[model samples]
Target chain A: MMPAAVAEPMNTGTPLDKDASQADLLRSARFRMEREAHWRRLDALVTRAEKGGIISLSYDETRDLVEQYRQAMNSLSVARDISLDRALVAYLESLCSRAYLVVYAPQESLGGLMGRLLTRGIPQAVRRSALPLFIGFLALLLGMAAGYRLFIEDASWFYTFVPPDLADMRTPEASANYLRSTIYGDERHEGSRLAAFSSSLFSHNTRIAILIFALGIFLAVPSFVLTFYNGLVLGAFFGMFAQKGLGYDLFAWLSIHGVTELAAIAIACAGGARLGLAILLPGRRTRRAALRHEAHDAVKLVILAGLMLIAAAFIEGFLRQLVQSPILRLTIGWGMGLFWLGWLLFSGREKKIRRGRS
Target chain B: MTKKRTRKSGPRIEQFVPPEGVPVNFTIATLGSRLGAQLLDLIITYLIVFICAAGLFYGGMLPVEAETVLIVLLAFLFRIPYYIISELVWNGRTLGKRIAGIRVININGRRLTPHQVTARNLMKEVEFFTPLTMVFAAAAMSNWGIALLLAWVLAITIVPLANRRRQRLGDMVAGTLVVNNPRSVLLPDLVVASAASVPEAEMFDFLPEHLDIYGTYELQTLEEVLRDPARRAVTAEIESIARAIVRKIGYTDPVKSGQELAFLSAFYKAQREHLEKLRLFGTRREDKFHHAEGANADTAADPVKS
Candidate 1:
């Protein structure tokens, strides 16, 4: 266990200390003398970065900061290896961490991040959960079919399926003409409280989407149920409209934004479902690691969902009111739906090939 | 892992080995300190929410719809972003953490990313706020519901206790760590004053045979005794210790009257050089009583040849 350096002198350099402790101190003192300037410069730069952020530094300073940071990091390792001066080591540790914070911090700027997320991040995430996304889509479709059947058998079943707040004017007892006017908005909602209700509804929908995704972490049952329940409400509304032979008109009206809106919620639910299933079947990874790994993609999908919802809200608020023709409305609805489907499916697949080749 | 917590109540040391292969050590923030920081953050966030709510309800400056929207917005807009943005912009410190001298760092020794910050903060909604609200909201509803809510809250509360790193669910999921900020001061170099540093005295020297009698423990004791600020008035104490060391080591040198300090300094320097040359470091030595064991540790502590 013992080194024989004690029996034989391993004093390779300058001389032994007037003996050892002083010589060792002299070595560290010399170490400090050689590198103290860089540490001091880095400290000042880091203090400035902390106060104002990386943006405040000049280009030259940021460059210098990185060079000095690496120098400090190197000094830290050397100090640990040879020096026993705890205080010097501690100072170097603090300096390196501070400088590391500045240097390795998220390097993408806001606009850059946005561009990447929209172009690659969202689509890639949505693409990864293709199976869950399809399952979510099927859940909504099945719920719609179930609601339509239940309402056709008995109009009174609407109350059981559709909550009052969302039911609005499309009641079973309401006249066909009145229902038509509400769908087409015959000067009723315009110049009125449209702004208030529209914003409120937008916020409500987005909150529900986020909640669906958040609740997915617990095994995705809640998310799936909520998505199904929402589908039922929509189907029940369509069923009531069909009773008056305005089914086609209602489809057109809903399609203007419903395609985007429904799909967004389904995507969000799919994100949650991914998280939920990750907990149950984490595969080879630890449960925590699997969940975290899935969560990264899931979060990207959530962001995509929120953005799509906003896009849907704009269409619902504007195009849904202005457009009267069912044919054109259906076209716009299906067109937007296909756009998202194609984008999510194919947008980022060739990202590697397209990148750096140019 | 925490064998490094040598004192009964010392801060735990966590080491991170970055890709550069330099393993740096950081002092993990204590649980009590983290709780304090959380409490401060909660207070700060609540104040912000309270201020915004007050302005919305009492300001009487906006239309009814706008006020309602803003009041609702306070929950979404302020509290969540306060934690996220502060951590992101301040490089892993919220105002509370900055004040408490702690920071969130990536466990891998990388810089904190926005995604990491965002993930951890978002989990706060699920981990802390939701459980807390469930307890308060369900308390009046049913005994069963209250019990379930409390259990949920309790489970999350004990998560940090489950690991040596004190990571909560959020921290685990996000791969971040909260550590005590490094102590930040470069101390002056540690060198025993040679006779040249003082006026009118030349140095004393000791041979390896004379130096080898003492180990690191005694060297440290000698160092403290000589470096003590009040040594000026304790000349007799210094002289006695010097004479005792000379007698023990059997050094054949005679100390001039006032030069006991010089003799001890040289012996101290020589003894440390001897111990370090053997690579006996970092509390591996006690005193001359265990010179044999110290010798064993010296070879063990030395690095193997590459």
Candidate 2:
């Protein structure tokens, strides 16, 4: 008996023309017969690779696999173009894509990834964002100056600039003792108090940074406002403390954690502003393209900023309340500030080493 | 007649052709499935945090304050590492994506990079989680905060809806797509033998021109029509479809109404062979659109030429 053909007619319609149908059947049968071995071989190789990664294959096997993949892709293109068999075309398409991913996908080690990100990714992103960072700083400074001028001129300006819930230390009419207590906290319960403070501060700062970065898609206005508003609150509190003759103490207290905290916020704002600039002034690129290009750096900046906030939270929680000496606080604050500056500047620089032969 | 024309002309499947010439056929995942995957991931994350918190509480090793601090930090920072590590390890599929049978792929055809994974997952913090936080924050503040938060949520939600690719804000920003991973099995040759014994090819004869009129895409559609048991039961519908195909291909010989299905079956077999032969020669046709529109017109003018 002849091989029962898969394409058997559904019903007893008009008898098919035997000669033409037999010839067509022979062509299809021959086509499948010729290609079946290679197709089966490719399928087995792919299945094995999928089950136990490409690494399981030997070098020669891997080379042979790639050659098979190329031949299969050619088969798929040809099958798609000329073959009328849907099932055949579908099978080839699936095989080719799976092989493509297996052969072409990249694999990297964790240590290598960390090294590249640290050495090249974050630093380059930061450097690229210098202009936006500067703009963020300027906006903050302007807000601070405005708040200071307004508060010094009229005490009522304090209410406008600083929300009452957030104004823990420098509330109007608070005595010096109360102000000092707010900063140092109850000395006996310092550990728990600082932990709570740090957690809350971290959450607050991280949330704000994320918001600024997220809002940057809207042309940066909201980011600018939030940054300026943060500066205004800082200035209002400063003015209040100076008015109460605790200006030096306030500066000493803030310096320990404020440098890092402020820097993180500024960087976040800068990241947001960068996104805004991309949308507003896309240069030669389309708006979408510009936004996509800048978004990568902006996201990196936000990640860096988030890390900085975490560090600031650690310092604010553990170190700030425990240390009482104003001079020590000053020293630690300046040291951390300088350290960050130096790290940012020199961390990723490539150095050429000179060697002399004996 | 209208039904046949509509079935023949309508695009049956979605195809994304990348600019980089190599045809990668990926099925874009629906938003509902993607959201379902995210929901699963969210539940898993919460469960992890809950288990850790319970363990810390029962262990009694640390002070309450320290335990609370640890739990809070874990809750906040856990998602970042969870997403980054999973995607990097599993090649753009988290446990959630894996379970849902979807994967994140670089839309531009390059290998998924660590940077792209990190960027997309980090944006999720802003796009999804932070907005919920903002809503809570808004409840504490004036109406302006609520308005702002609502707008932010709406903006992110609308992005995926507006795009044909169904790319979320994170996907657009990161240049990735979530596609249903193709799952196919080796199929027996459709033209292989079956139980029914009908004459193989005498019902119809297709000229080269008739075979050339349609590419593999249309061929697949035609195969689907022939395979449908429901359509086969309705002889009137099948006859109409066969007639429409004949008309479109400009067959010169009139097909008897009774012979329409048989003609289609024979044409299917012949066209499959013709296409396979063409493929062996290294020439390819992507779909009907890939061929110049005028070729069918030229073939129609010279009906007997094939």
DockQ of 2: 0.33
**Model 2: docking quality category:** acceptable
Q: Which runs of model 2 end up more than 4 angstroms from their true locations? A: A1-33, A36-56, A154-165, A168-170, A190-200, A350-358, B1-22, B55-62, B135-143, B193-222, B225-306
A1-358 in candidate 2: lDDT tens per residue? 2223323322335444544445335344545546877877888887777657777788988888888877777777656555566667677877777776677654434557667666666777787788899978877887878787788889788888787778855686789788777666455656776787788779778878877776777788888888998888888888888888778888888889888888888888898898889889999999777877998888888888888898899888888878878788888887888987776777665531121221
lDDT of 2 by residue, B16-46 (tens): 4433345757677888889988888888888
Reference-based TM-score, model 1:
0.71
Chain B, TM-score, each prediction? Answer: 0.66, 0.63
How many clashing residue pairs appear in each of the predictions shown? 2, 12
Pick by TM-score: which candidate is best?
A: 2
What lDDT would candidate 1 get against the real structure? 0.73
lDDT of 1 at B279: 42
